[model samples]
Target: MAEPYYITTAIHYPNGKPHIGHAYETIAADVAARFQRMRGRKVRFQTGTDEHGLKMAQKARDLGITPRALADEMSSHFRVLFDRLNISYDRFFRTTEDEHHRASQAIWLAMEKSGDLYLDRYEGWYSVRDEAYYDESELTEGEGDEKLSPQGTPVEWTVEESWFFRLSKYQEPLLRFYRDNPEFVRPATRFNEVRSFVERGLRDLSVSRTSFDWGVRVPGTEDHVMYVWVDALTNYLTGLGYPDETEDFATFWPADVHLIGKDIVRFHAVYWPAFLMSAGLPLPKAIFGHGFLLNRGQKESKSLGNVTDPHELADRFGVDQLRYFLLREFTFGQDGSYSVEAIVNRSNSELANSFGNLAQRTLSLIFKNCDGVVPPISGHTDADTALFGHVDRVIFQEMPANYDTLAFAQALEAWIGAVYACNAYIDEQAPWALRKTDFERMQTVLATLYIVIAQLAVAVQPVMPETSAKLLDAMGLASELRDFEGIRSHWYPQLAESDFRLVKPKGLFPRIEMPAEADA
Candidate 1:
């Protein structure tokens, strides 16, 4: 087995239904996990719901159910959506899990023993919607001078006896850490923003709450529950079986990356590292703060009443098409706008037209002209050799790098270029025309085309898994063809100068019926 690689998505709070923004981050992390696994890494991908918070408690109370009951219901919904999106999470933990509770308390005890935790009274602006405490300066003037949280959530004065983390003590340490390890936070601009915030100054953070009972209880205290953010962030460690020092814990203690939305950068980049430092644990390798999904060119949020359900969108467009549109339609680590029109355009133009058409046309020609089998390569011209070389240079080398760096769009663009190259080669070679005259040359052309299509089918599996798997299956490729090694061998004995059986080819992506609003 390869070295262990651990990665996580920010746990979604179970107080509200999931939206496109939530799906975007989860999908991004899923792609990364799939990529890591295909690279032969032992990958542990953890994702689930944060089931403890004031919002959840209130949501539960309003529904006439206990918080735990409500958590079970809401968490299941999130899981169903994940299942629909085919998120291959290794563990779907809930904050209410006994293991998570133990992990949270153990970490709290370590921080307390390290002199980082103290009982104190907190009086500040709090946004239950965000489940965060904000400094007064972090508040901005709202309509009629009603102050609002930076997220525009209405902030109310919250005062309680709580436990505080020695975040102020770690300001210089965090600054030094950032300077020494520039990659701890990603997308240089976001890292710079975090550095600037630290430079401005840090304050001790309230780590436990007396006001909310729906949280992890403090280790030595009964009246206080750990702050929701504190409990939620510790889910990463819990998933790794931390505090007990098991083999899994030792293997994956420092996560490869914490894939998170930009809105939570402060929590993960600032407080999370400090908490780990206080506990004398290694920090994660990276915290990637990717930008949000925009709805109709605006930030997607519950308050805006513009949250698009991912299932609804996936229902209209296929799961793979929606997945392709998300990763391909925009640059990773940057805000991306989405609409029905954009999805339709990308699906019809790229998936249905570029990739699907290329597959169908070539597969049909080979099946009809070459007797529905992989024809033998009798010869190769320089142009034919160069076409295959392009796949080696671009698809095999650069595309993987793009995936490693979370350059989803760049990677897809490269893979699509390879697809187009194959299509252009077939057009230039005119396999159909040659089949009527120069049968041997036509056979060589068809064989080369089959090889290129197989490469693409494997290349896109990380994002469009089901679709790619179907294409590979129809091509009589093995299930083991997902790895780069399998792809590197040009799919091996299956391509070794012999005729192979092929399942009937079908269109991989059917063009969508564009909604009328897309025209706008």
Candidate 2:
């Protein structure tokens, strides 16, 4: 039996309204899950909101509602958005849920059993707004501008009762982990940052806060609730049925990946694994720290009034269009700015012009020339042979390898080149024009075009699901056309002969128009 693959998105902190950043990470995780499924792996994709935290307590106070009520309401909004975006997550685990609370306490108790917990009085620069405590060196002194915190939040001194985790004890072990499994933390930059931080010596981190009572109580300590990061990270294993049943734990305990944002690399890459190791549990296979999405030149900060609502974008451009634009706009692991013009340009030029056009023209020619029937493979030319070989090599060989690296954009570009080549093949062969005079020659060209598209649809489906579905439907193609290995083998398979369905091809992506003054 093959090993089951498991992955998770960081359980989002429900401090306030979620924005595009939340949607972006969720979508990225969804793609990984969907891709693994296409590769024939049994996958568990877990995502949820972090409900218990200092920010939740503050948000509740501001709104004059109980923290439970606020978390309950905001959790619905996240669920609605994920549904709207068509993000197919296997399990959604909330931090406030009973399973999570149980697992959170269990981990704490286990650490206590391991002698990794201690009673400590913490007097440090804490940003209640950030739900994080910082060292004195991390804080700046004085004024509106000079007192900016690391996340650009203003700093304040907080002295409180706290329970500390002996994170310092595991620093050397974590360094050894990196030395042994170098791929544990990804993007190299994130790995290097974690290594440098450990090299500087780990601090015994405050694992609970006495100032707030909205979170999980440090096991046996009623005055202190678990720190938000520690509480939130436990949701991954909690969703896997950890500290509960052994069957689900046995299958998916060591997750294949933890897809997270660059901001919390330390929490996931350093502290999360350390907690698991302390409990004698296995660590996740990889922690991929992806970059943030920026607006124009500045980071998209909600306080600065720069947050963009993802619903508004999804409404304007369709969901998969937004998905395609995001994946294509930037190389993964790099910050990319979002712009209306940029989204529209990619939709029209890349999707509509390049991909949709090829599908439309090819299917149209097939209907016109071959009596709307998918033709049999017969005559072979140098161009036909070369393109088929390229398809075989990419889908069967190259793409499977790149999937491990999570390079979907690179794979998409390669498939786009194949689409372009198929269009160029159409122009050179002129199958529609040659149909009346040379019937056999026309059949060969149409067969090649159809086969090329069948391969393209399978490869591109994880990126643009809706468009790929429509293309296959129009060709009277089987759903098996969506299978990764199925479409890759041969150019012509025994496709079912259905009724001649003439789909009046609507443009999958329409171009965007901008004002002249805005260009300046």
Candidate 3:
């Protein structure tokens, strides 16, 4: 059997229209899943919408519709946007689905059996807007020094009969888990944040709510419903066939990674694992808290009127270009700013000018000079082998860590470095100059370029799928790539043979013009 690798994105809340930030995170996860599969791992990638929560209920009320109806309607919108973005999610779980509700109840029952659950009359400051309870330290002064939620939303006090998870009991265990698996929390900074929060002392969390009727009902209690996070987090397990005896549950249990935003790292990296451990289930292997994408000078907040439609971006810049730019612009696990000018610069400089131009000139030169036929390798040269090593190092050694860390920008940079090397080799070797004086050495030059260009097409495929695919097709090679190891082995050697034809190359990324108002 193959090695199992499971991954998930935090189920998005469908309380509002999809934005570029949502597309950014999904695209990041898509790259990870694609890379892992290329490494020959059995990958399961799950993404979904959180359909039941106070926010969803309120939005539904505002729309004059039932929560269930609203969820059905809003979920379709999210699905459409994801489809347009070409996101490759394996399972799209909805918290309102029966499988999720059953699995959530099962988790509650298991925690109850383990004595990790308790009944209590909860009295505390709660933020229905945030769907979170807050401590004094977690809150800060709003206008006039009034207490606000951590997100800066105003809070209100409430008392109700609720079930609580004994998170306090497992604070030491969680710290020990962090100690045992330091790599479990990602990006170093996010790990430190979780460690700091746990060190400050764990507080028992309210697991159920009595005021809202739009959530999963607590077992044997009509008034109490599971908290949104508790209910939504269970969708991860439910999507894998939890609460039902099945092979998928056994095969993919305990997800390998949960790729989430920095805002929700606590719920995933800390509370989530404690919940699983208390239920006697294995914890996910890792939780990567990736940073946000800011637009202009601020985060892309709808309140600030800065939200950009993902479809518009895709329309303006090709999807593959946008994906490459987003992954290559920001280092993974850190906040990065996005602007039209910045994206245009990257496209023009990196994709269009560097990579696309390399392919265009190489093929054009071959078609014009070599009668559209690949040149045969004639003799040995140390420079030729050394250039091959540079490209080989990127595909074989550097890529794994970059993909493991989700730093696609670095990975793509490494690929671009190889492209730069190939172009420089062409300039230094002067293949055109050698053609008249040393035709044999010129063949060697063309053959060397062939081998590395073939590798580049395969190595960078996962990052820029459509672009890489088109480039490979233009090389008259079959548009299929093997797994990373197979590609590393070069299973099909005929791909770089001398008789291959140089098919016409098309523009992979076209330049975009910025609006004149922004130019000032």
Candidate 4:
């Protein structure tokens, strides 16, 4: 049996429409999930909306709608966007789901049984925009003497009767865990930040709120609702049928990684683990907090009137094109900037002119010169052997190693290197010229190109699933032979022996034109 691998995205807070940041994180998670499946892992991927919070409540009141009505409307937009981006999440979890409520309450009861829960009067600086409480030490001054959270969001003094979790009780344990498992958080910078925060003394955390009713109701309490983070984080366990310990929970608990934006690393790294420990559940293996996506080097914000709708971007640039550009243009753990020109340039140069052209040229050669049939390799030249070696090393070894570590840019960089190698090899070999000078040699060259082109398609499936599938299908490659192992098999010679005929190929990536405004 394949080893089970589970991954999740931070459930998005759907108080607003989905933006490019949401699209970036979920698409990256989907890439990882698809990559794991390509490696023969039993993968369970989850993403969804965190619909219960003070933020949602306020947004609903402003619109004169009930929170449920607001949640329903906003959650569907997220779902539609994820679908549009071809996100292959196994479960689109919602905090409003009944099972999720039960799961959250069950975990609450477990923590209560563990004596980590107690009633208390809570007074603190809270950021409604962040849905987080801030320590006085963590607050800063804003305009007109207003207080702000570290994220520069407005903070107000909030005082209420609340339920507290003994977060301080797990302070030493959390530090010890960090010390023992240094890789619990990713991108060393985030790990360092999380560690420094935990090293400082932990105060008891406000786990329930009395001021807001738009949240998960506490297990045995009528008036208090669970803190938004508590309810939101439980969606991970809820997706796996947590309280029941069903087959999914038994098989895929202790998620391999939680892919989230860098802004929330503190909650996932510190509070989430402590909550799991309090509830006697195993902590997830890793937390990777990736950086943000910027618009032309500036953060996108509604106030700036530059917040880009991801759906619009997807419509303008193809879905796979956007997916490829996001992963390729940025180092995985660092912030990246994108613009219309950047997208168009990257897509045209890498996808359209390079890999897409390589496939189109190779397949077109076979269609015209080899009578639209799979051509057999009559002999191999030194150049052919060299091309094969380079491509095999990249596709089979380097790409996978980088991808395993979530080094998406590096992996794609290596992939494009291999593509360039093939393009160079094709040009030098001049298979078209070989048609008159030597027919068999032309067949041999075209055959070699065909094999590597198919391999490249298989290698790129995780990033560009639709485009890769279209290219591979046009080449008459079997659907079953599209994985890492399957691509490296001797299926190529067998394919050539079979009487499979290829159709004239359509270009997978058309050159994207820069919008006139972008040119300006």
Candidate 5:
């Protein structure tokens, strides 16, 4: 079997429509999945909806529909947006699925059998909007008679019969886990935050609720439902067929990473690992909590009237451009601000001017001048040799490391640096003018350019799949040439040497005009 690699995005909630923030997370996970697949790994990429929550129940009630109906309708919206965005998740699971209920109950029983779960009366400050409970010390007085959680969401005092997990019991072990495995949480800052929270001490987490009837029922209880986060987080294992002893479960039980937003880092980094430890299960290798996508530096919220739809964004700007701009515009772990103006600027300058222009110009030269056949160089100068070596070095060496670290912007920088070098090589050699004076040398230069463009096409496929396929096809290369091995010295040169036929290549990305109303 190929080496297994499993990655997942925090599933979207079914209470709301999918937004740009959801798309950002899915696209990031997709990029990682695609890169790993191209590198010959057996990859399982999971994304889905969290359907069981008080928010969903209330939203369904307000909408005059059943919660399951609401979940079906809203979850379909996420699927549609993901399909449009080309997120290649192997499974888009829903927490309401039968298998997921089993997985949740299995873990619950295991933890309970281990003496970590206890029946208790719970009273706490809860944020319905956040699906979280907060202590008085952690809350600030909001409007008159209201208190807000640390996240600024309004809280209500909630009391109920509950099942509590011994989260406090795991605090020391969690600290030791963090110390022994420093890289278990990413970007260092986020890891330290989680550590500090553990050091301040942990409270036994309420893991089931009697007040809500919208979630998975507690394993042996008739009146209580699993806490929404417990039900929600188990979807990860459900996607892998946990408790079933299936091959996917056996191979991918300990996921390589759990990709989540910063807002929920505590849930994934603190509560999740503790649950796994209690159940005698291996933990996920990493929990990467990435920053939010802001609109004009403000969080996109419905009340703010600024929640941008992913479909509309894709409709306005091409899918590939949106994908590239979102990933490249932000450093992967930091907050990123997006605007129509910034989108147009980056699209026009980088895609249209740099990559698109170079591809179209070079491929058009080959079709018009070289009889629709790929041309091989007659000779190699020291400078020519150096350029070829540089492209080779980037393709085989630097890019894999960049993708491994999730440094997509830095990866693009490396690929585009080689792109710029190819552009410079064209300007210096003047391949177009050389076609008339020394046809063979001109063919050589164009051939060199062809390899550079083809290599670039392969490198960027994770970010811009459709455009990259188009780029490769226009170069008269087969679709099979897309794997990382395609860039290896063994196969690429042989194919480049053999091919002389080419297709008329058009501009891959069209420049978008600035919208009349965009943020400054």
Candidate 6:
């Protein structure tokens, strides 16, 4: 049986329509899930909207709609975008679902039964935009002497009757867990930040709110709803049929990774684990706080008039091109910027001109000169052997190592390096030039290229699923032979010996044009 692997993207808050950042995070998570599946894991991937929150209530009021209506409408946009981007999520969890509400209540009751819950009068600064409470020490002064959250979102003094969780009581236990599991938080920097915050000290956390009734209602309480984070965080479990100890819950609980944005590291790394500890549930294996995606060195904002619609970008640049550029252009867990020119240039230069050209030319040669049949390898020269070794090192060792560490840019860099080696091999071998002078040698060269090209297609499936599928299908590769392990089998020799004939090849990555305004 394949080992089970569970991964999730932070369920996006749906106060507004989805943005490029939402698309970026989900796409990266999708890639990770796909990669794990490619490695023969039983992968369960989850992503969805966090629908019950003060932000949702406020947005609905501002738009003269009920929160449920707003959530339904806005959540569809995110679902549409993910569908368009080919996100292979096992579950699209919504907090408003009855099952999720039951899961949230059950977790709250578990913590309550554990003596970690108490009613209290709460007074603190809270950011509605962030849905987070902040200590005075963490607040900074903004214009007009206004207090702001650490993220620069405005905060207001809040006082209400609430139910508090004994977060402070678990501080030492959490520290011990961190000490034992050094890799619980990723990138080293985010882990240090989380440890620093915990070392500073923790206060009892407000887990229920009386001010808003738009969230999961606290058990047996008519007026107070469970705090948004409590409801929001339980979503990870809800998708797996949690609180019932179902087969899925037993198999896929304690997720392999929770892929979230950097801004929410504290909520995931600190509050979430503390909640689970109180509930006597196991913690997730890791929390990876990935960096933001900036638009041309500036964070996208409506006030800045530069909030790019991810749908428009995907439509304009092609889904695979956009997916390739996002992973290729940026290091995971570090902030990266993108522009129209950058996307277009990277796609055209690397995907279109380099790898795409290599595949097209090699297959076109086989289709036209070799009479549409996969040519036989009469023999291999030193150049062919060297090319094979380089590609093997990349596809087998370097790329997998980088991907395991979530170093996506590094993995793709190794992949492109292999692509360059193939291009160089083809140029030096001059398979086209040898078509007449040495037809047998030419056949060997084309066969070698064909084998390596199929290997490249299989290797790149996680990043560019559709594009890779197009190339592999065009080359008549079998579905079962598309995985990493399956690609390494003796199928290539069998394929060449078979009667499968090559059809005219079509280009996969066409050059993307920069818009006039983008050039300006």
Off by over 4 Å in 3: 479-481, 490-493, 496-500
lDDT of 6 by residue, 1-520 (tens): 8889999999999888899999999989989999889898999999999998788898999999999999999999999999999999999989999999999999999999999999999999999999999999999999997998999999999899999999999899999999999999998999999999999999999988888789898889879999999999999999999889799999998999999999999999999999999999999999999999998899999999999899999989999888889999999999999999999999999999999999999999999998889999887889989999999998999988887778889999999999999999999989889988999999999999999999998888888999999999989999999988888888878888899999999998888878999877
Q: How accurate locally, in lDDT, is each candidate?
A: 0.88, 0.80, 0.83, 0.93, 0.88, 0.93
TM-score of 2: 0.95
For residues 1-520, could you state the per-residue lDDT of candidate 5 as single tens digits? 5688999999898688898999999999999999999988999999999999898999999989999999999999999999999999999999989999999999999899889999989999999988998878999988898999988999999899899999999999999999999999998999999999999999999888887699998877969999899988888898988888889999887999999999899999999999999999999999998889999899988889999988888988899999999998989999999988889999998899998988888988888997777777688777688888988788778888888888888888888888888888888989889978999889888878887788889989999999998888767667676877866555545665674467676789998988877732
User: Model 4, 323-440: lDDT tens per residue?
Assistant: 9999999999899898999999999999999999999999999999888989888879899999999999999999899888899999999999999999999999999999999999
- Candidate 2 vs candidate 5: which has greater lDDT? 5
Backbone clashes in each candidate structure, one number apiece?
A: 0, 0, 0, 0, 4, 0
Candidate 4 displacement at residue 431 in angstroms: 0.7
List runs of model 6 lying over 4 Å from the truth: none
Q: Residue 53 lDDT in model 5?
A: 86
Model 5: per-residue Cα lDDT at residue 473:
75
Write candidate 1's Cα lDDT for 1-520 as tens digits.
6889898999998787787877888999999999988999999999999999899988988999999999998889999999999999999878889999999999999898899988889998889888888889889988996789877888889888988999999999999999999988888899999999999999889887787698898977998998898889999999888778788888887999999988899999999999999999998889999988888799866678887999999999999999989999889999999888889988998889988998898889877876787787776899899999998777679889999999999999998888888878978989889978999998888888888888888888889999988888788787776678887874544554456676567899988998766664
Clashing pairs in 6: none
Clashes of 5: 4
Candidate 3, residues 328-353, lDDT tens digits: the string is 98888899998989888888888888
Candidate 4, which ten residues in sequence have the lowest lDDT sum?
370-379
- Arranged by lDDT, best first: 4, 6, 5, 1, 3, 2
- Model 1: lDDT to the true structure: 0.88
Cα lDDT of model 3 overall?
Answer: 0.83
**Error of model 2, residue 338, in angstroms:** 2.2
Where does candidate 3 have its weakest 10-residue lDDT segment? 490-499
Candidate 5 global TM-score: 0.97
True-structure lDDT of candidate 5: 0.88
TM-score of each: 0.97, 0.95, 0.95, 0.99, 0.97, 0.99
